[model samples]
Target: MSLIKTEELVHDYIRRDEEGNEDGRIRAVDGVSLNVNRGEFIAILGSNGSGKSTLAKHLNAILFPTEGSVWVDGKNTMDPDEIWDIRETAGMVFQNPDNQIIAQVVEEDVGFGPENMGIPTKEIWERVEESLKAVGMWEYRKASPGRLSGGQKQRVSIAGVIAMHPKCIILDEPTAMLDPSGRREVIRAARALNDVEKVTIILITHYMDEVIYADRVFVMDKGRVALKGTPVEVFKHVEELKALHLDVPQVTLLAYELRKRGLDIPDGILHMEELIEVLEKICR
Candidate 1:
């Protein structure tokens, strides 16, 4: 079943003059339609200003569509009465962890969500424990958010969302600010949540390497989905992705190059190991 769905979604940003006079409207998200199935790990890829982040906001009802509809867990985002319910059903983790982390201590931050939901104290603590452990941050439950590393803080932010027990998590460039190691750490935590916790993941990132493991990938250009397929299927169009000002996984690019040079390498070779195996086969 689709945990989230958007139908002809259109969002426009209205520009105003200095005196607050209406100038014009710029369409950020234009005619976007997609479905995210329950328990699926979906990646959205695009360069800056391609409307990927705009689309992510609609899923969480952070921005209502100007023309179409968005439904989260069968709850319509357009309904004012269902707004909070939709948000609770789909938690959003933004690029900066600092903005998301409220409490000083880690456990308190994680518990904040459940606490706001009016959950009992005992249940809130239970959720905090479960959430922190899920993100591999349980060991630092007593640590201050200020003291944690970039990656650790991001994990805590994720745990905070998990405490709400949302069926799906939308991460909008969650690792954009992290170093390579920190990026790996946060992505690992996201994968764990999807694999072990069976929570749906919608990850929006421009990093080619990150989406290689996704069940499916959607590439956006000019506020529309230009490409949609499994990772292998999408990466197979290396030239097409480049035309969209996007990059494929490094191995996929190398394979594409080799194929161009009259090698027998196949399209969409995602990993170095896969390339090595194919090269060895050709050598034999």
Candidate 2:
């Protein structure tokens, strides 16, 4: 069964004057429908202000749809009473690690989510340890968050969400503010959680390289889904992606350019190994 589903979802932004009179309206998320199955790794790709984040907000009931419906774990998001349950089922990680970490110590920070839910103190500590270990941050559990590097801090922030035992995780540009190495660490951790923990992952990323591991990819443009498919299927449209102001993976781009220059290499060469194989085939 699908863990999250959206039907004809629409969200609008009203341009108003000082007195709140509506000047005009912009539909930030237009009539879009999507379904995420349990234990799937999904990537949403878009330019800035493309309504990808707006669509994500609907997953956890952070924002209500102006029209249509959203269901999280079989519960309607519009139901006010189910809000907490939905939030508990779907945890969100934002771009900044500093904003997400509140507790001084890493272990304490990880336990806060379950602690606030009125979980027993003993169980909360157990959950904290397990969650920290899951993210490979157990060694830093006793360290202050301020003393940790960006990658470590972000993992701790993720560990806090994991302690809640959420069925799904929505990460909105989680690595945008990090350096390349830090980005690698967070992405690796995210993939590990999705692979081994059976948690649903919705990764919102602009970096084409970062999404090669996702099971499916959705491309958003101007508040609409422009393309949807597996990584190879979607990245094959080199010209179309370029027209949308998006770039393909580095190796994909190189292969596309090489193919255009009369090389027999195929389209959608996503990895370096694939490009090398194609070149070897030509030499043979």
Candidate 3:
């Protein structure tokens, strides 16, 4: 069964007058339909203004669909009574970490989520410790979020969401501002959350390298689902991705260039190691 499901979802931002009349409307998310299964790591990919983030907001019920329905853990998002319950089931991590962390200390920051849920003090502490440990930030639990790196702070923000025991996590360009190493840390932490803690992950990122490990990838455009498939399957369509104004990973693009020069390389060479191995085989 799917943890998150959307059927013909549509979201529009309407310009309103002071008299409460609709003037203009822009369809940011248009007729998007997708499903996310429990424990599955999914990637939502698109260039900016593609409605990827808009679509992501639907998963956590942050933005209600103007048309169609979204179901989180079997509860409809359009239903008012199910809003909080739906959000709790699918936690969200945005692009900026600094805006999310409020507590002076890391452990306290992580504990805030469960604390808000009214978990007992004892259980909240337990959850904080467990969540911090899972993200490899247990040693820094007492440190202030301001002192941490962008990656570390992002991990703390993730720990906060995980502390709530959410069934699914939606990360919208979480590593965009980080350095390469920071991006690695965030991706590693996200993968650990899926592999170790068995949490469903919906990662929205443009780094094609990141999508290689995802169980599935959905590409968005003009507020609609433009492409969808496993990483290999999706990346296989290099021309289509290019048409969408997206690029493959550096390694993948290099391999594609080599292939265009009539080399015996494969389509969608995602990582450096893969490219090296393929070159070695061709030379042999």
- Candidate achieving the largest lDDT: 2
Stretches > 4 Å off in candidate 1: 17-21
C-alpha lDDT values of all predictions? 0.93, 0.94, 0.91
**1-284 in candidate 2: lDDT tens per residue?**
79999999999988999999999998999999999999999999988888999999999999999999999999999999999999999999999999999998889999999999999999999999989999899999889999998888899989999999999999999998899988999999999999999999999998999989999999999999999999999999988988888999999999988888999888677899989988998999
User: What are the per-residue Cα lDDT tens digits for candidate 1 across 1-284?
Assistant: 98999999999999999999889999989999999999999999988999999999999889999998998989899999999998899998989878988898999999999999999999999999999999999999999999988888999999999999999999999999999999999999999999999999999998999998899999999899999999999998887888898998878888988999999988778999999999999999
The lDDT, on a scale of 0 to 1, for candidate 3 is 0.91
| lDDT score, candidate 1 | 0.93
Tell me the lDDT of candidate 2: 0.94
Q: Residue 138 lDDT in model 3?
A: 98
**Poorly placed runs, candidate 2 (over 4 Å):** 15-23
lDDT string for model 3 (102-215, tens) is 999999999989989999999999999999998899999999899999999999999999999999999989999889988999999999999988999999998888889899
Sequence-dependent TM-score of model 2: 0.97
TM-score of each: 0.97, 0.97, 0.98
Distance (Å) between predicted and true CA of 230, model 2?
Answer: 0.1
